[model samples]
Target: MLLLLPTLIGLVVAASIPPSIPHETLEVIPDGWKLHSTAEDSQTIALQISILHHHTDYLDIAHDVSNPESANYGNYLGAEELEASLPEYQRSAAEVVSWLNNHAISKTTLDGDWLHFETTVGQAKELLGADFMYYQHGSDDPVLRTRKYDIPIHLRDAIDFIYPTTHFMRPKWPAKMHLLPRQHIPTGPVTCATSICPKNLTAKYNITHVPADSNSGSQLGIGGFLEQYPDHKVVQQFLKDYGLRHHDKPYKYKVTLINGGKDPNIPAKSGAEALLDVEYGMAIADSLPVTYFSTGGRPARTPSQPGNKVVPRNESGNEPWIAFLQHILKMKSPPQVLSLSYTDDELDVPLPYARKVCSLCAQLAARGVSVIVASGDGGSAGTTTKDCKGPNGKLRFIPTFPASCPWVTTVGATNDYGVAHYSSGGFSNYFARPKWQDKAVSGYRTLLNGSHMAWYNKTGRAYPDVALAGSGYLTAGGGATYQQKGTSASTPVFAAMVALLNDKRLRAGKPVLGFLNPLLYKNEGMFRDVTEGDTDGCEVGSEVEVGFGASKGWDAASGLGEPDFAKLLKVLT
Candidate 1:
């Protein structure tokens, strides 16, 4: 009777089990890879698992808060309120922790929606149901990865994705500066100087005189990455050289380092990208308080490292972009306006990873933070490198990330208020067109009349939201002055403008311009429409074809055009 009862219990347990189904293939090990016998069992691996939760309600609430016409427009959620609202998020986090604990994985920590822990390669392989091996791309260093991964069916709903998993993203600093000849420098500042000084440009754009009471509580920030450090001395000299200092006082900004981020005072380690971003942002928005975020993390191995590894590599072993955004999201008092000059080609990033990043941007926007990103400098052809080439060897049109995200304002480049030829502009392949820009994009598509239509995704999100000067601006770095060009220059300029606008709104007892698309699209009169020049590159023949052009209305090359400060103030206030 005891043996029969045991057999009956075993049969019931076996009958309750469900068949396994195929889930997402997190990674695919490249062909011709050799396994590391020693690494398989002995090596310890770290995994940063991202849990999924129902964000639909939160997104809806955010959208309402962002929409100016809505009743809840200015009612943004605080960090505590946000956490409390997402019961599903809390539940998912607890479930993931419990599951890990049940598996005897004790080293785990939870932050918002991410669960981080370390485990052995053997345990990871068994846990994730995947094989791990070593593979090298070309002459690059070898990496340890798996071709595919599987999760238990029950846990799939709770997991969104994991990083350092399958996706590889390389965010680039978009500043490309050329050293100006000594003869080109003016002995004294001239009205409408050819060098395009920040003062002259600000005056031209009608942002010359900000009210004394403005910018009282408004704050602006710039994102720094890849060990790039902005020196205070460089910024001061730049302000002095251009004669834009405040009563002989050197311009100053607070540098906040995150995740081992460094701001070494050594001039040799300082970069032009950092200098230009700080100079333009501070110089333009002279009245506002500014913060420079020095975001540090391990260098991504996909685009290859810059030779030597001086900084601690893989300290967190997390992707820099994700880490940077996550850090910002958790901030209790993030800057109202944040400018980022970094970008990467859209296709280089995996779809799930890109979507997750974009969603994070949405979260930031919902909290009334206006995030600005440089579109790209690659024109319609994408980055001018071998990596952008498709498998067919044809030069493909690659859109850029963060810029391609519809939640944030994407800034393009122009020369002398005209669309710059190299200013990257196109529709996105990953994101669809949002309702705000439908009329404008539809008109632009009609103008194209199917010209180069086959090369791009027409139904995708189009950029940029606006354009600004991006050519031949003087920037100081390494104790020398250089002329910088690219959408990087344009981004900080626009970000400064938005920062000033936010200041005005805050002073007027109004909400900061959150998720600027709806407001920008609705208020066309606030900007000067650029109707000249064309963005042409990705040379197929001897002649460069025009990819997109500036038009009377919104066009991909120049979007709504440069900002008109007076008009913007009137509309916003």
Candidate 2:
């Protein structure tokens, strides 16, 4: 009876503790999305459950392989090699599968670390102890989701997060640029005074070397999101009008569609953002092979009407960036340099989701792929707006995501004068500063001397890792010429520059510059430092010039100045 009494007490204690814990929760639904009626019990929902993955030191490995001084420099991991390095997940998978089976959900597909399943709303609600509801973003069809969910306490260690939950990140409309008819086409060398052309950029940066045919394997990728599709005819017209030498007569580029994405050549439906991206990238890189990744999901649907027919109806449930990454990461040989000219505010994305995406970027870096992203166009404010106050109603500076992610290279905007006043640059409220950029950012912090201290997080990650000419650029599309400006223009142009450098490295038998931040920080002399201009737009009520300004070295306004192609080529080789 004494031994039995101890056993009985142990059983009672175990039964008293709650079986589940909160996994992902939000106090309220994110803005730009409205809650509709509760989802029907019979309505089906597809969920991607992310099992918590073992953290690998991909950052350390990326830095080691990218540093020029290191003996292991350029020794990047292949697909199988990287797979072998990851921790085995048999135990984690078994536990999650067991929990799902307990809820009568036996049909599930496991892809890498993600478990995919389709279940009715009633069953899903009972499984996760959540209330499912319909959420409509503008005029788009409603989506099924829950404000919060809980998982069994025993399975907490095995699962990282799940989605179709609290994450509401969707594609917004691209930046608006006023289109103007062309007055005249340049028959000779383009001048830098009127507007920026491929010729002007090549001359300004001293980019004389064209990619050789032998280095065609070195490709550049331009990420296209929402419904933006580039037209080949526009690109051809741009090359001819600008009088820039190109590899192909028709100006060809490969199209890779992901998640039911489309690549149509319809002139009327051509997108300005897509045209701007491909026009400059193809012109600058010249003969280098370029691939346009048209990723579907997060359609550009407004309250008035649906976006163009560039995406599938079923794709509305997925996130564009996630869909893009899922496709790109599977390839054995992706492009050496990939550029994305899209950005969202850091606070708008959930912390867990952001970390997960950033880790994938780190993996790409380890595989010798350089990812470049635009640093937004909101100056020191937020994404495409000039508000000084933050989401919490506090007067603070806002930073953009992916730019603040630390793994990818973030590019800011500059003009013929100096740094563009609307070039977005600030410290992140989410990620801490990486050690690689400590010296460069510290110099700027010292120059700042504690000014605007309360407006930002001092210990957070700082960005606009590099800068480029952003304004007064000419782009052609849909049989019309237009003038465009923003960090989006600068991103593709800089990516094209990197693509050329990749070609040189391949010809020289050296590896492509995988993660460029480590190398760029070490050799500040490769860039032409801009000691003038300020990122000014954060004026609230009576405050004037209430944002970050450029300094002698690295500043938030123009990061390490614009790239000098000749100097970069010499140092890189």
Superposed on all Cα atoms, the candidates' RMSDs to the truth, in angstroms, are 4.4, 4.7
> Runs in model 2 with CA error above 4 Å?
1-18, 31-34, 136-143, 182-193, 214-216, 246-249, 299-314, 388-391, 539-545
Worst 10 residues of 1 by lDDT: 299-308
Q: What pairs collide in candidate 2?
A: 52-160
Task: Give the per-residue lDDT digits (tens) of candidate 2, residues 28-96.
Answer: 665567886666687666777877877676666776787778998889888777666665766898899
lDDT of 2 at 167: 74
Estimate TM-scores for all models. Answer: 0.87, 0.90
RMSD, model 2, all Cα superposed?
4.7
Candidate number achieving the greatest lDDT relative to the actual structure: 2
How accurate locally, in lDDT, is each candidate? Answer: 0.75, 0.79
Per candidate, the number of residue pairs that clash is 3, 1
Model 1 steric clash pairs: 27-147, 28-147, 29-147
Q: Find the candidate with the highest TM-score and give its number.
A: 2
